[model samples]
Target: MEKPKILVTGATGSTGAPSVEMLLQRGHPVRALVHKEDVRSTRLKNLGAEIIVGDMQNMDDVRAAWKGVKRGYFCYPLNPDLLDVTVIFAQAAKEAGAEFIVNMSQKQVAATAKSPATIRHFLSEEVFRWSGIPTTHLRPTFFSEWFLYIAHQIKAGKLQMPFPEDARHAPVAGEDLARTIASILAEPGPHINRAYQLFGPELLSYAEIGEVFSQTLNKDIIYEQNSVQSMADSMGLGGSDHFKDHLANVISDDLFGTPDMNDVIEKITGKGPMTLAEFIDKNRTAFTT
Candidate 1:
C-alpha cells in the first residue's frame, strides 16, 4: 500500500523543522508547507521533503498544501489573525479529508485570560475539536526558546526578565516538543483526540534560570530585578501599547500561575524530557553570542 504523504505546516519553524527531519528519517513521504522559498525551505528540500510555498491565511494556498495529505502538523505565527488562519486550516483540512492533525497550542492558555493571544489559542483548540477532525493538541508551556528573549542580557553577563523571581513555569525544549509531535505523527492511533500538556523536567523561576546559566556557561551571570516598564524599555518596546497590555497580563495573572507537570512526553516518546541545563548546553553558542 502506498502511504499518504504528511504535510508539515510551519516547516521552517523551531518545532516544524525538527518534525520534518524526524518524519523524513522515518522514511515517511512529507510535504513541507512553508510561507516562502528561503534558506530554510531549501534545507528541508535537501532533507528529502517536498516543499510547497503558501501562506496559512490564504485559503487557496492552504487547500493546495492540504491536497492528498492525510496527516499534518498545524502551526501558525502568534499574530492577531491566528484564529482566522486556524479556521482556514481546519476548513481546508476537512475538505481534504485529513486523517490526523497535530495542533501547536500553549500550556498557559486559559478561558478567562485577558491576552488576545491566549484567548485565541484557547478558542483555536475548541475550533479544531468541533471540526470533527481526528486531532491532537500539544499545549506546551514557555518554550526554552524564550531564553533568546534575554540572550542579549546573557551575552552581557546579566539576566533580565519582566517576571518576578518567584514566578515559575516549567519551560519545555522545542526539540523535545518536536520529538513528541513526530512520535504522534508516526502513530496517530494512540494519540487521537488527545490534548497533551508538555513540559520539561523542572519548574524554574528566572532566578533559578540565572543559576543554570551561571553554572552552564561558567560565568558570573546575575539576575537583575527589573520592573515591567524597565523590561519593556530594555527590549525596545517601551512605547508599544500591545506589549504594555501583555506585560500587564503577566504581572496581574499569567506569570504566577503554575503549570501541571506530566510524563506525557516520556510516556509517548519513550524518553524523558530535557532539563534547563541540557537546553542551555545544547544551545550554548546562542547564549554565549
Candidate 2:
C-alpha cells in the first residue's frame, strides 16, 4: 500500500523537523514545506522528504503544496498574520479534498487572552473547525528547547527571567510533542475534531529549574529575578508591536500559569513524558560548551 503523503509546514522548525523525521522513519511519505531552499531544507531532502519551498501566507503556494497530499500538519510561525495564514491553509486544504489536518497551537489560548498571539491561535483553531475539515489541535506548552535561550544565563551561574522565580510552568519536550503529532497524522481516525493540551510530566518553577540544572550540570546555578518591564525592554518587547505583544502574553502566562501536568502523551503514544532532569542530562553540552 502506498503510504499517504503528509504535508508538514514549518518543516525545518523545532517541532516540524522532528515530526518529518519521525514520519519518514515510520515509512510514511512526507512533503516538507519550507520557506527557503537552504541547508536545513537540504537536510530534510537528504532524509528522503519531498521539499516544497514557499511562504505559508501565499494561498497559491499553499495550494501548490497541498497538491495530492491528503493529510497535513499545519503550523505557522509567530507572526501578526496567523489568522490570514490559517484561512489560506484551511481553504486550500478544503479545495484539495484534504482528509485530515493537525494544527499546532499554543497552550492557554483563548479569545480573551491578552496576548495577540494567543488570541490569534485561538481564532486560527476556529478557522479550521469552521472549515468543516477533519482537524485535530495540538496545544503544547513551553518547550524544553527554550532552555537553549537561557543556556547562556545558566552557564553564567544564574537563570534570569522577566517573571518571579517561583512562577511555575509545565514545559513539554519538543520530541514528545512531535511524536504525538506524527502519531495522530499517521492515524487520524480517533483524533478527528479533538484538541489535546500537551504538557510535561511535571511542573517546575524557575528556582526549581535552576536547582535541576545545578544538580545535573554539577555547577552552582541561581535564579536571578527581574521585573517584567526590564526584561521586556531588554528583549525590545516594551514597544507596541506584534513581537512585543506576543512576548508580553508569554510573560503573563509564565507568571500566572499553573497548567495541569497531564498524561496525554503517554495515553496517546504509550510513553511517559520526559522530565527536566532528563532534558538537562541529554543537552548538558549546550549548558557547558
Candidate 3:
C-alpha cells in the first residue's frame, strides 16, 4: 500500500530538513515547502522530496503546497507575522482536507503570557485547534542548534549567552525533534490532538554546558553571562523589533524557572534524545578554532 504525502514547511531549517529525510526513509512521500530555491532546497530535492517554493503568508502558495498533502508540518521562524501566516496555513490546510498537522511551537507559551511573541505563539496553536483538524502540537525547549549559531564565540574560547548563569533547560537536539515529528507523521492515528513538551536527555545550565564544551573540544571555554539586550544587539537576528522583545521576555522567564529532563523524545522515538556532550562532539568542527 502507498503512504500518505506529507508537506513540511521551513523544510531547509533545523528540524524540517531532517524530518524530510526521515519521512523519505520511512517510505512516506514528502513535499518540502521552502521560501526559495536555495542550495538547501536543492539538497532536499536530491533526497527525493518534491520541493515547492512558496511563502507561508501567501494563501495561494500554501494552497498549492497543500494540494494533495495528507499530513503536514507547520513551522515558522520567530518573527512578527507568526499568527498571520498561521491563519493562512490553517485555512489552506482545511481547504486541502488535511488529515493532520504537526505544529512546531515553543515551550512555556500560554494564552496569558506576558510576551507578545509568546502570546502570538499561543494564539497560533489556537488557530490550529479551531480549525478542528487533527493536530499534534510539539513544544520543544531550547534547541541545541542555538549553540551552533554561536560557534565562532565558542571557537574563540569564550561563550556568551542571554540566559542567567544558573538558569537551565533541556536543550533539545534538532535531529531528535525531527525523529519525533517523522514518527508521528508516519502513524498519525495515535498522536492526533496530542500535545507534547519535547526535551533532551539531560538538563544543565550554560556553565555546565561550557564545561562539556571544554571537555569535548579540549579547550577551556569560558561562559559569560551577558544581558539579553547585548546578545540581541550583537546577533541582530534579522533586525526584528518584536523578536528582540520576545527574546528578552523568554530569557527573563527562564531566569525564574527551574529546568529538568523529560522522556518525550524517548517515548516517541524509543531512545533518549541526544545529550549536550554528544551534540558538541558530533559537531566539533563548529566549535574548533
Please, what is the TM-score per model?
0.93, 0.93, 0.96
Tell me which of candidates 2 and 3 scores higher on lDDT: 3
Least accurate stretch of 10 residues (summed lDDT) in model 3?
Answer: 251-260
Q: What's the residue-level lDDT of 75 in candidate 3?
A: 95
Write model 3 residue lDDT over 60-123, tens digit each, in one string: 9999999988789999988879999999999999999998999999787776776777788899
Best candidate, lDDT-wise? 3
**Best-matching candidate per TM-score:** 3
- lDDT (0 to 1) per candidate: 0.86, 0.86, 0.87
The RMSD (Cα, Å) of candidate 2 is: 2.0
- Per-candidate total of colliding backbone pairs: 0, 0, 0
lDDT of 1 by residue, 1-289 (tens): 6666899998998899999999898888999999899999999999999999988989999999999988999988666788999999999999999889999987767788787777788899999988999999998877898787668889889988767777778888888998999999999998999988888888877788889999999999978777778777877778866566666675444544655577889999999988999999998898887
lDDT by residue for model 2 (57-95), tens: 899999999999989999887788899999999999999
- What 10-residue stretch in candidate 2 is worst by lDDT? 251-260
> Which segments of model 1 are wrong by more than 4 Å?
229-244, 250-258
**Stronger candidate by TM-score (1 vs 3):** 3
User: lDDT of candidate 1?
Assistant: 0.86
Q: Using TM-score as the measure, what is the rank order of every candidate, best first?
A: 3, 1, 2
**Which runs in model 3 stand beyond 4 Å of their true positions?**
251-259
Pairs of residues clashing in candidate 3 = none
Worst 10 residues of 1 by lDDT: 251-260
